[model samples]
Target: MITAAPHTTPGVLDGIVVADFSRVLAGPYATMMLADMGATVIKVESPTGDDTRAWQPPVREDMATYFLSVNRNKHAIALDLRDDDDLDTAHKLLAKADVFIENWKPGGLAKFGMDPEAVAERYPELVHASITGFGTTGGAHLPGYDLLAQAASGLMDITGEPESSGQKAGVAIFDVVTGLHATVGILGALQERQRSGKGQHIAVNLMSSALSGLVNQTSAYVAGGVVPTRMGNDHPSLAPYGPFAAADQPLILGVGNDRQFRQLTTALGASELADDERYATNPARNAHRDELRATLETYLQHRPASEWVEEFRELGIPCSEVFSIAQGVEFADEIGLAPVQLTGAEKVPTVKHPIDYSRSQVAYDKAPPTLNEDRQSILEWLDAEEG
Candidate 1:
């Protein structure tokens, strides 16, 4: 729920035009968020289409799910940046755009004269968001992808089940996170543009976001002289704070301190265990976690995960039954957490804006666009601009 602050909408970025020259996840996701906040995003695709357009499996309506998942409420236009005519058209849009986002390989866009530096020099008022695999700095030449970044940042070294050798997350978390950072950078630059009447160059990369996301673990490793280990399903400092097998399914429980620990034990009909010397304190319980786990399992085996969740919740312990993906979505909906959505006007797939603004409404009211769907209208506008 991190939101752009101090700016109430008419939409914070209202009336801004974003020339999106990015393909795939990170860049599209950033502009998607901007579009949700009232920016006009015109997505430019090559003749073969964005790479994700062909990535498939859960295909629907002849469109790539990968493409649909991130892109919506956008106007897509086919362009060939290497072609003089196409490059001319892009520059035409750039002249009037307030933001430009691109994720070409380092120097890839430069070869086509779409480099941020070159464009910025020409249009100092346009905010430039450059998304890259590796940052354009020390490791600029190295390739970057979400999984690669997870490994490079050492997150994969501590992510999965210990037996599984800490793997990359199933989802491309780094890419998504990097996109969010890029969005934030764009918004910040937009705000700064208000004061200076000129835009600044903003860049976001997967490596930086992945590293930034390793917050607590990174701090402990850097300052406490400890290399983090794969804890698997357990919290490093909390006792009995991971998954436990119940009769029907696994449940996750968090007994923060002695008080909650006592309540949890009571709920499980093992009151005396709470008073036991080795289980009486958080540290002690953590030290004897296996023993405590065995005790909890012996009791939990008598009830389903849902029952246990209810019992622990009633007793004031932080606990929940592990849910399947569908169940999680249903639960989010049931509790007023909107997850899926359709953008108005275009009937496009859009997830709910993550931020809940009390004063300013999100800008999205339409679905993501199809490839080159708005080419006619966009070109018409660009054509009319010369007049």
Candidate 2:
């Protein structure tokens, strides 16, 4: 288990207020980042609460871990936008908020008068961010689900083995990446607001984010006119850059350049392989990857993966034995990454923010809230809001 950092640092967004009309992953993750940075985030849920509230089985204190994962450091309140009184409450919250975020289907909130365009018009100084499955162009009507976005954006198509069916990532990776994009957009808008004295609408969709997140995979198609297929553990352009079998377990290698490849071969007691014309350069090594893998595995299979990992790491080659999630957390802890943070009075295990700020570290005191847990307090605050 990862150890927690001392949760006493103040957030950079200390005075910023966020009206979080988002549920599930993308929007909530973005708002959670803001909340951790000291924004007072008021999560405005529907009368039934966020959909992930019922995503259980992996529950703590009878609360869904799914909900807990991305909803921390924020207040929760239920509101029925269909009702005039609750709608008024939402309006009040948004009016006083510095940032507003939602993931309703494109144009879904137009009826509620809180769509991106409407919000931008009504609150010209408020940062409005909208997350959708697709943009408001030809595909706006489609719902935004991670799996659908992955398949539609060609991420799943390039994911697993070339011979096997497409596979969705282990996690809702596109959703998380989209969330990061939304957060960056919001922050950029906030910074620009200082110069323009006005806010702007920040739009992000899973499909767009997924396509962009594919990075080199999509680039190979768009830039090089090469439609990349799934290579499983094999990298399309790199040799000795995937997992090989050891005596006990699988070991991953990342020989980024010819220099690293040389270092790897030298460490493996196969320095002669580096001098071979077919394995000399990266492109040549990639062209002869099958033969190289067979040769490398012959030496790798002589020892346990753990032994190779240590020796290869010492030789400045990137390598590791495949680790389970639990092992991953333990390894991070051992390396002083402090991957988990204990938050709230109950001290729940939450992932720490990955970035390390020199002046201001992330704050993680408050836990994820229960449904409508702060309704009375939030309403009181909104009731006291000035024009």
Candidate 3:
């Protein structure tokens, strides 16, 4: 139910066109980022619409908010690729597109002659980006769901308390990570095409992105031969680095090094604790984390979390009171981030893209469209281009 803004500015990716055949979270999220940067992304869905369109209950004007979250600033069209005419229309769109993105199974699009190999051969200049739950090899048969990725990638193994069952992230983290990887791959391929005058395939799978996104945790296993386990909110290596009770509520302390530990102890009126051999160095403090926590809480118990947050911030200590989603957004706005914007005539609020550029601005011209709302105009544009 979001619509186009009346006035707009040209974006950095103004000339690029994206043929977005991606559905659901990962693929659509990537194309949305592209659209935010000013690419003309044509989202081609099935005749029914993208699957997320039906993921409702949390609805906005009867449209799925989940769908709206990643479909903004793009035109949409419904086409049944199973039908010959609709398949031909897709081909025509690809012919004029700078990038083609999809998340179908390995051979899913082969019947329609839209497989990566076929698309690459037919549109030699177009970047073909593929997202899958797993890679097209051994794991292709498996579905590419975020929870599965979290479970398979050792993420769930290291998450939550040791005593509790493994838990998936609050959000679809791997999906978002995979989308980011796809966007990077597409942009890199586009850059390479500038010199070679040809595009290449960019394959990103959720499992692969999950491993990479795990970063230090994966490194602990692969590089150090240490299989990390769940420790709840506590960091495996960094002591005094998790949430601690602060009179009224919990405050997270991210004291990473000896210097920060010293600063924290000083701020808490417990400078003597930092001087103790058992809590002086990071490794030493980690060894006695329980004792350190017990000691710190004695001093922290006098002040509320908010007061501690302010005092610790002024002292350059990395500490914060845990915030709900609404509070997080409000904090961002209060700090002059201007994180939200109203879109379309309905004035729907959407998050602004996180990045800022000196020479070019991110576009927020169009809102998430109604199903197949731009089909006629898109087809007319295609005809004009073909002519």
Candidate 4:
């Protein structure tokens, strides 16, 4: 099991060192983002490796795709943190790290002497980011999982049809979003550390991230007292903003404003529909959504979704044909988004980091690591003095 950092590009986070003690989705995803940007991330796994290592049925090269998706660009080692010698190694890594991340249960790291207060006291300049299922208080005892966060955050309740059972999203969306949040928080803290000359504790939890990620749905309740329910694919506040049937399949029409609505109507060869008093404004369109949908379907039914997608797009109306994950990737490639890249020994497929920095770009230097593969190198590095 070899882990080699590719030498093709420069990274923005080139000098930063991260001591990663996270497993599963949220924490690993965040650290991976850091690694992509040039942080030297040491992923400290347990004796058996991260739990996602066994999450199979979707294995590539006998490796769980789940684990592969988020663990790239890092050096990995397995250690029994409970052992005195192994715990000392972890402490040595932390002493040199500019950032430290973990997703263990609240209070779980205290027994190993890695608690927030202790770490801060030991290494005052180390930025410590903690990911939990819940925060460190009332909900601390409850284990965090993506499904539980979705349920507790009211996301599931507003996901499906009003009459149907609440449905979780097709992916672990909240966990992913939480991971992004954690990345943002870590970066911000690092920026501030430049001036403060001290590190701070950053905490992110699945439930809170779910609520924040809900955005408009949560806003309707908190700001307007509206307890929004599932409208299926239809948006709660916008009309002609969901999937609509075509001659052969469903195409999504996202008329964000009256101008887009007019374009859509003109593209459908039904310009008069856009001028109707009942559908002139966004508010009016929402009020008359059912009628508007029916009128659009009449025109959309004349062509397949692909044809309509082209015509509507040419007219500057926001529209697209529904696609599977593979198709979505193909479309991205077709449009020059370059959504994926191959890295490391197996030439594994990895999704590109979402942002494109012109001057200091993200680098796909290392592929996802194998268990204890970099143990000797990382231990030797950590044992050295400050540059």
Task: Supply candidate 2's per-residue lDDT for 126.
Answer: 97
- Tens digits of lDDT, candidate 4, 1-387: 222233456678887889999999999999999888888889999999999999996999999999999998889988898899999999988998899999998888999889999999999999999999889899999888999999999988999988988999989998899999999999999999999999999999999999999999999999999998989999988998999999999999898998998888877788898889999999999999999899889888999999999988888888899999999999999999999988777689999888889888687767888898899988777666434
* Tens digit of per-residue lDDT, candidate 3, span 1-387: 212222367677778999999999999999989888888899999999999999998998898989988988889899999888898899999999999999999899998888988888899999999999989989999999999999999999889989988878999999999999999999999999999999898999999999999999999989999999999999988999999999999999999899999999899888988889999898898899999899899899999999999999999999988999999999999999998977656667788887898977787777798999999998988888899
Of 1 and 3, the candidate ahead on lDDT is: 3
Stretches off by above 4 angstroms in model 3 are 1-7
> How many clashes does each candidate structure show, in the order listed?
7, 0, 1, 1
Clashing pairs in 2: none
Per-residue lDDT of candidate 2, residues 1-387 (tens digit): 111222466668877889999999999999999888878889999989999999997999999999999988888899999999999888988899999999998777999999877888999999999998988899889989999999988888888888889888999999999999999999999999999999999899999999899999989989999998888989998888889999998999999999999999899888999999999999999899999999999999899999999998888999988989999999999999999999888798899977778898687777898899989888877766652
Q: Candidates 1 and 3: which is better by TM-score?
A: 3
TM-score of 1: 0.92
Which residue pairs come into collision in candidate 1?
A: 72-368, 73-367, 73-368, 343-366, 343-367, 344-365, 344-366
CA lDDT of each prediction against the hidden true structure: 0.82, 0.89, 0.90, 0.89
Poorest 10 consecutive residues by lDDT, candidate 2:
1-10
Q: Clashing residue pairs in candidate 4, if any?
A: 6-365
TM-scores of the candidates in the order shown: 0.92, 0.97, 0.97, 0.97
Candidate 1 per-residue lDDT, tens place, 144-175, comes to 67888999888888877777767878789989
